[model samples]
Target: MFRLFGFDVRVQSGFVVFMVLIVALYGSEFGWWLAGAIAVLTLLHELGHAFAARSAGADAEISLGFLAGYASYRPTRPISRARQAWISFAGPFVHISVSVAVLLAMGVNPLSRDSFDDSPASFAIWWAGPAIGLMNLIPVLPLDGGHIVNTALDRVLPGRADKPMIYFSIAATAGGAIWMFLNGYQGFGIFIAFLIIAQLQLLNATKPRPSPASPWELAGRALDADKPAKARRLLTAALSHPQPIPPTSNLSMTPARANELIDLLPDPYPHGDAGNEYVLANLLMMTGRFDAAAHYAAGSFDRHPNTLSATIVARAAAALGDHSTAIGWLRSGADAGTSDSGLAMTIDRAPELTGVRHHPDVIAIRRSLATPG
Candidate 1:
């Protein structure tokens, strides 16, 4: 691991192996230069992503790995879709630009070139930059272009964009691989096969599975199905599952992104709950069932009374036109063993809780949570 351009870079063993293999296969000046160009251009590609990500108020790390390099990043907050697409495009953009500049320096017109010279440096630049970069822009999974398409789909479809993109990536990669082999580009074909495998992995992650008969899982399914009654029932029925359930696979929304914590707790936050009553109540409130949500939110407070639940109940009450109930719960929440300041801030931040925000209990807790500076 090393740092470059203010970004952490980890060169994977596979990357080293790839370089050595390529050099041995060609065994000439072109081979050595090819290896060199891949290393430099791949790093530059990732750096393009890194620079753009940081400009968008994110921290990034570059990992140079097997067939490609990636820039993983975490934004201080959610990033806009346009900015995200730009970040993906930036990598390939840098590569193509460098190729163009090199062509200009060599007194070659990029458009009119019948064939690029096979001189060591020229061959390396052509192969690594324009060739690889243009390929990366292919609208398939595990490529920069694919990521651009994914970002656009996210804007148009939001949570529903995964399967479509994954399926398209799989199909396109398979077809491209077949064409590459048929047309005597076996090397490129093998690379596409690798990309197809990546798409399959993604497909598996997003694939739905039959979970054990846990109320939390059931509640989640019910929410997905838009069955509010089922959701409320499952939430109320939450008991620990008899057997441990496997963690659900993560569906990757964006490519090559890693996140870091602002603060670390002694342990990781729990991944599941028996019934997830708080979530159900919150869902109910969101779906305009304030009465049921307010009534059910008490179950969460009963099980694990905390600022989160208190805020939920108080806000639901306020939504139901019961300002007195809202105020009463807010006071009780302020007295609860959790952070008074957190409760105060919660109420203050919720637009629905405007009715209770000015209550004396809320005021006191907000003042308590406040910093002098």
Candidate 2:
């Protein structure tokens, strides 16, 4: 790892292996000067992305690998789609610009060509920048062009564009690899195969699983953002889901905020009472409405008996200054073999529960949590 332009740049071991292989395969045409030039260009291209991201007020880190480099940007919060698109395009823009400059120099300066006559440096000057730039422009997932495509699609389609773009990357890479092999560019063909594999891994990683964010959860987000209309829309959508939707343990909003969100939902909802009630209970407790939260929670618990509902009820009762009820919930959960470590930790760390932390019953619950069933 090294720091360049205040960005942490990590060069993976595969990068050195690639450089060595390049030298070994075409050492006669790939001298030290040419190799250094390619390396410098790669770093500069990545820097373009890093600097662009930082300019956009996003924190950026870069990683350079054998065949490619990546720059990751994490904004303090979400950034505008246009700003994201600019950051994605920045690297290729810098790379292609350098390539053009090199070409123009070679065209005008007679000595520039003659000085490196018959050397690998000549090949580097002609091909390195342009090749890297063009390859990066191929629309493949995890690639700069792929990112550009996704960014554009996201602007138009929002959440519906990612999978299709990834599929496109897969098909494009496969076709490119086959074409490269048929045209005697075996090295390039193999590289595309590697890229194909990488894309496949990414696809697997992003495969749709059960997301924690139900309509109620999304509504909570909308309410937090002071957009009750959006929250209402989300809740309406949540009401449409098939019955017996499982409770989510991933509630992120506090009780106070959750109640505000619940209050915003329009009446005459179309939800299955069990799941919606449990979710509502969680929201209530998060906003410090412990008494009402406990009422909703008890009903949800009688029907569901899951770790999530139990945790919500226990935490709510404790925050309402009722350590005994909290202890009872914890004890019953443990006895029934439904309690979870994550739920226990949530209760343990809650600021509202700080008053009960050293209480004997709370310590007993903590001990129960530490012991395996």
Candidate 3:
């Protein structure tokens, strides 16, 4: 736990160490004043995001790093691509505004001019602001620019955002590294290479596991199970191929067979089977097939009761005129205590559980849910 600008912040161990190293090195090379200034600037940059998120009625948390900061907010509502793009651009917007203001002051005022001269503090502020802003604007995965690119691509191409953002990050990082090396910025070059490597590892880490069954096979298995009819229907909708599969009893019927069925499903969700359930549940809800929606939503909750799925189930149950069931599911979510602002917003907006808004458990649930997406 940490505190900055009257707000509580949390820092991971690695992040704490990174911040300490940055402060120590900068303070040693320049002075405590310069280090402190940079810290303040970083905080302000992140605060811009926090402010924007809060304005959007989202829960926000700030995380500070050695050379970076982020304001994470829960995305309770469906944010359009343009909104997402603006949110991504907001932090740099603040930094750039400050930079321009400072530069102008220095030019206009004699006192400010002296500060901008040979002093390390002036130099750090002048360079760091633009540098940090531009760095974050780089179209790479895990950066603000990457997010902007993702949002833009999402608007134009829909499903193609993530891959392109990743590819762009890789290409840009590589190009930046080469440019840095040629410009005699060996330290910067090494840093860029390290960043690219880290991003590569992240990409590999998030890669989906290969599935054994096709969707149709999984649907058949679900049908064979002694589940409720509604559950079977939901599962069938979820597991069905976009294109019709030829009906046949000769297909294998084991769990392995179910795996084969999923493999046959076309254009499966990027997050794999778990994501498939989410898409299926939402699709049912959108179609106003409340019973089927409830079934898949419940299935989603059972298999992966993350905030997103849980909230969906809760809402679906409410919409199905099962207020008790919706409230119960929401209470269960309150107990799970997830930390996603988006989920929190969803839960908060649930019609069935409005009475519990001020309850301690619900409030705590809200706090956890406040974390940015």
Q: Go through the candidates in order and give each one's C-alpha lDDT.
A: 0.73, 0.73, 0.64
Per-residue alpha-carbon lDDT of model 3 for 183-249, expressed as tens digits?
8888685458657876797678668877556444455555567444534454556444332432332
lDDT of 1 by residue, 1-373 (tens): 9998899999999999999998998999989988988888898899999999999999999999888888999999889999999999999999889877876798665665454563666766688778888989989987889889998998889888879999999887778777877898886756776898889998999978865554544554665676757655543334222224432323221211111110111122221352344544555566666776677676667766766677778888888888888877777777674766557556767777887677786676566654321
Give the runs in model 1 whose Cα sits over 4 Å from its true position: 108-115, 208-336, 339-373
lDDT of 2 by residue, 1-373 (tens): 9997799999999888877776776666565655666777888888899998998888999998877777888887777888888888889889878866776676533235554344556557545676667778787888888988898998788988888888999998888877878998886766676788889988897877875566667776677788888987776566445444665646666656666666776653334455666667666665667887777677667766766667667778888888888778766666545646755775567676676777787677677676442
> Candidate 2: misplaced stretches above 4 Å?
29-31, 106-119, 209-373
Whole-structure CA lDDT of model 3: 0.64
Give me the overall lDDT of model 2: 0.73
Which rank order by lDDT, best down to worst? 2, 1, 3
Error of 3 at 106 (Å): 5.5
Output the better candidate (2/3) by lDDT: 2
Candidate 1 lDDT at 137 equals 91
* Displacement of the residue 138 alpha carbon in candidate 1, Å: 0.7
